[model samples]
Target: MVIDDSSAMRLILGRIMRSLGFDVVEAPNGAEAIARLQSGAMPEIALVDWNMPVMDGLAFVNAVRREEKWRQITLMMVTTESEQSQIVRALAAGAHEYVIKPFTPDAIADKLALLGVLAY
Candidate 1:
């Protein structure tokens, strides 16, 4: 799953995910992503963005972490917000990995590999 308010970002990330053998699903905001989850879209990993309308990434992470059924989903934050404190907060909120904006596809792949989100 790729959750970002920017359609271009979503397209880029979705393409990368598909190239890496994932069936990508996208939502423009955290609320819609959560709604997708509630509707039985059990993605193994979710690439989320920080700044968005209708609910941000941190809140999404919190909401997912609160639910027992969603615990298996790996949450990765992909956003422009690059602060040490922000990273710490996302991790504390149950995000498994963090990637800043303007990243390469390789950077995303590397992080996914590091997190074991990519299946061999």
Candidate 2:
């Protein structure tokens, strides 16, 4: 799943996910993403954006980590928040990986591979 406020970003990430042999689902914000999850959309991995309205990525990670059913979903933050402290906070909140914005598709794939969500 790709959770981002920008439709363009969603499109870009969705295309990348599809290219990597995965089905893609997208939500414009964390709240809508949660709704999709509650409605039985069980994505193996969720690429989330940090600055979205109606529930930021950190809050989404916290919410997902609190639920046993959502434990298997790998959360990756794809955002412009590049501070070392921000990355640490996201990881501490159960995000499996973090990718800053302006990243290449290869960078994303490599991170997914490192997280074991994608095969090299």
Candidate 3:
């Protein structure tokens, strides 16, 4: 799943995911992502963006981590939040990986490979 407030970002991420052989789903914000989850949509991984109108990525990470049923889902922050503290906080909140914005598709692919979500 690609969760971002910007439809353009979601589209770009969706294309990247598709190139990596993933079937993508999209949510405009964390709230919608949660709603989808509640509706039984379970994607293996979610590429989440920070700084959203509804619920931010950190909150989403915390919410997902608090749920046992969603334990196996991998969360990756694909955002512009590049502060070291923000990265630590996201990781601490159960985000498996973090990628800053303005990233190349190779960077995203590398991170997914590192997380074992994609084969090299």
Candidate 4:
């Protein structure tokens, strides 16, 4: 699932996921993503933006971690926040991986590979 306030961002991420053989879902914010999940829509990997309206990515990560059933869902931070401390905070808060903005397809592929979500 791609959670971001920007429609262009969602489309970009969705296209990338599709190229990687993933079926993409979208939410404009953490609230919508949570609502979708509660409604029985589960995506294996969620690409979350750190800053957004109606709830941010950190809140979403915390919320997802609060539920036992959502433990298998890997949360990846994909945003423009390049602060080391910010990255550490997200990593500390149950984020499986982090990818900064302006990232290339290969960058995402490498991280996914490390996460065991991508083979080769």
Provide C-alpha RMSD values for all models, in order: 1.0, 0.5, 0.5, 0.6
User: Which candidate model has the greater lDDT, 1 or 4?
Assistant: 1
List the candidate 3 regions with Cα displacement exceeding 4 Å: none
Provide the global lDDT of candidate 3 against the true structure.
0.95
Collision pairs in model 3? none
- What tens digits encode model 1's per-residue C-alpha lDDT throughout 9-67? 99999999999999999999999999999999999999999999999999999999999
Please tell me which model should have the higher lDDT, number 2 or number 3.
2
lDDT of 4 by residue, 1-120 (tens): 999999999999889889999999999999999999999998889999999998999999999999999999999999999999999999899999999998988888888889998897
- Once fitted onto the true fold, the runs of candidate 1 whose alpha carbons sit more than 4 angstroms away are none
lDDT of 2: 0.97
lDDT of each: 0.96, 0.97, 0.95, 0.94
> Per-prediction TM-score, please?
0.97, 0.98, 0.98, 0.98
Query: 3 or 4, which is superior by lDDT?
Result: 3
Candidate 3 lDDT over 1-120, as tens digits, reads 999999999999999999999999999999999999999999999999999988999999999999999999999999999999999999999999999999999999999999998988
1 or 3, greater by TM-score: 3
